[model samples]
Target: MIRGDLHELNRISWNAATVRHNSHKQDQAGFLRSGGSTLFPEEIELLGEIRGKEVLHLLCNSGQDTLSIAKLGAKVTGVDISDEAIDFARKLSSDSGIVGSFERSDVYPWLEAAIAAGRQFDVVFCSYGALCWLSDLAHWMRDVAAVLKPGGRFVCMEFHPVAMIFDEEGVPKYDYQMPEPLHWDTGISDYVGDSGGALAVSGAENVSEPFVNPNPCAEFPYSVSGIIGAVLDAGLELRIFREHLFSNGWKPYRRMAELPGRRWTMPEGMPKIPLMYGLVAVKS
Candidate 1:
């Protein structure tokens, strides 16, 4: 009951966050239409050869990255819990002329159904802020392995667990080994820093007022060891693991600076810490 309630609250919060995130986002269709991709280089490199592969994207918020994969000639399906995100993803896919599918379902049930249905994919990709929202990686990784074809690969690029220990001011906040859900009262809002409400691209009205969503959010934290153990326990062979100094894209801290290729990193004179981690594991 507690887990279900947590998912419900987060689904509602993300539904609210998606609207604001979309508004700050500029020319999603136009950007893709012009051969631009939202995927960072790390994902591209980790994905290896995705062309013509069947790919499943878990918790694909708004299908932005999933569509980017579709644009690369992969047959991609994105699954998310937020109906608003899936709705917008379909619209974006159509508007950008990219062929892909998006489904609105909780990832656990969707994965179970996919496994029971014998639906398997050549690749399972989840990236950036993906792992924190999950209450447990053990169940998640087990189902993920079940949904992958034999010899299929799982590519993950997520914000490093250590990054969660710090506040925006470079001060330590949360513990890195938290194994339970953390309830947050502050409403999820635009992380893109768009205070001036504006919609980029065609066919949307630009509003100048800032949007507000009072919905609280909940997230779970898994230690680095916990994440690695789950994947290994799923019987997948861990092939590669890397930690990066720069973020995949989002600037979570005010003290950080953006570098080329849209990545962000801590400023000089600060200790260089791992902001993100990536891994590639293959079902054996």
Candidate 2:
């Protein structure tokens, strides 16, 4: 499929997922009202002390993490492809009294406009399931570099590509070194709220009702070298690269054990695999 068509399909699919994602108790509006953040501990530590910094959050669904960063005293601007997600994010920010800005646009075009407007940020932050949506990592990283000030930092924490090759049954379904984009026509949505339960709160009439997506989506599975090499080629110096054995959410395999922080790992006697990774690079 063409990149534009894939993006549009993903937009629709993600918009559908956003409604359910926002309603879930794990990401409930009230939880955000009480100063809860969706950020993992590793992400928080890597972005240590963002007070008074200008931060750009790419693929910031519903602005949960954006507001969290705002609470840390950073000026934040969140960019997302889904209008519904941005709308809910704006509402959440308003309802929670956290100050931040949001824009609805594909990341590449948004970054291009930011560069044209001479806007630069102290930090460019992205994470979790964000990178897989892009078809061109080099262009993406170049734009990332373009939007950052000299000596600025780019921090990304995401599901490791190695883990993405496995199916729900823990079998390897794709090549870890596959160079092309993968397409999936599965009608099921991957949002946490789809796990089955009533919403934690009511009165979200303005938001769309949750529903399953029947559309297909395409994603590019990039190797660690491909990702890091793109960052380096974009003129950013690598600061840190780390991998973790646990995922950030529910296990893909039923037999896996749940760990603290909503993470999941393999059961006893099973070989451990890196499920998540974080990268920090600086623009020199």
Candidate 3:
């Protein structure tokens, strides 16, 4: 992996270690709002059925999706760098009566260990908001490729880089097309919240440095071509890839009436670019 990528991985590790329990609890509400509704179920449905299939989830913050997949009869194991998130995920599994396993470790090392132990899965699943934290796509892809059994699938549904450019303000000034080189710095931003909105935390209420990480996680933007290339490099062949204007498992803000329940589309006459993309790739 590249030097910058290693730094980013370390940052994520640190963030996972330091993410405040209270803040994480608040964040879990957001995850349920977004993932529970659209991102999680959509990916699960797109994967068809995973009865008795072994699944691996990467960057599985808090493990809601992992547990959800487990509820569908997949023997699920989730790996995340954040200790607090993994703990909450374990609790969620227990509370929900979903049998699953979670591990706190960085992706590369975790996959290496899993491979060494002869671990393989029928599916490797990750989702939106997860990939942006990584610095190197190639290394990440290789790790996802390493622990998969032959014919196993790798599936991901992520917020398009295009969508990421628009912050809570909905400003379009940032470049949405060019994916940049990954870099890291020491800072924290609350991207999701109910009352205060993105990155706005009152001093009295907010935890000091609620999310801690050793590096700045770079948001690497990739075009459809870029995403396709990564999967191919990982010894996976594309089976299904779809870009959608709206996401059913998402709630961007309070005023987004166009996306109420299962609908994911921009208002009429508004620009119709896709907000997210889903991919289903099978091991070759």
Best by lDDT: 1
**Residue-by-residue lDDT tens digits, candidate 2, 98-208:** 889999998878888999999999999998889988878899999999999998999999989888888877888889877677877863264454222212232223233
Cα lDDT tens digits for candidate 3, 166-248: 65545564565564644446533443332222222111135334444444545465666667888898888889988877754
Q: What range of 10 consecutive residues in model 3 has the weakest lDDT sum?
A: 195-204
Find the 10 residues in a row with the least total lDDT in model 2: 195-204
User: Best to worst by lDDT, what's the order?
Assistant: 1, 2, 3
Identify the runs in model 3 with alpha carbons over 4 angstroms from their true place: 3-41, 177-188, 194-217, 249-255, 262-269
In candidate 1, which residue pairs get closer than 3 Å at backbone N, Cα or C atoms, i.e. clash? Answer: none
The clash count of every prediction, one per candidate, is 0, 0, 9
For model 1, state the Cα shift of residue 161 in Å: 0.7
User: Candidate 1 residues 167-273, lDDT tens each?
Assistant: 77788999988657888787665665432221232223343456677889898887888899999999999999999998755676768866766677889888888
> Candidate 2: RMSD over Cα atoms?
3.6
Model 2, runs deviating above 4 Å: 194-211
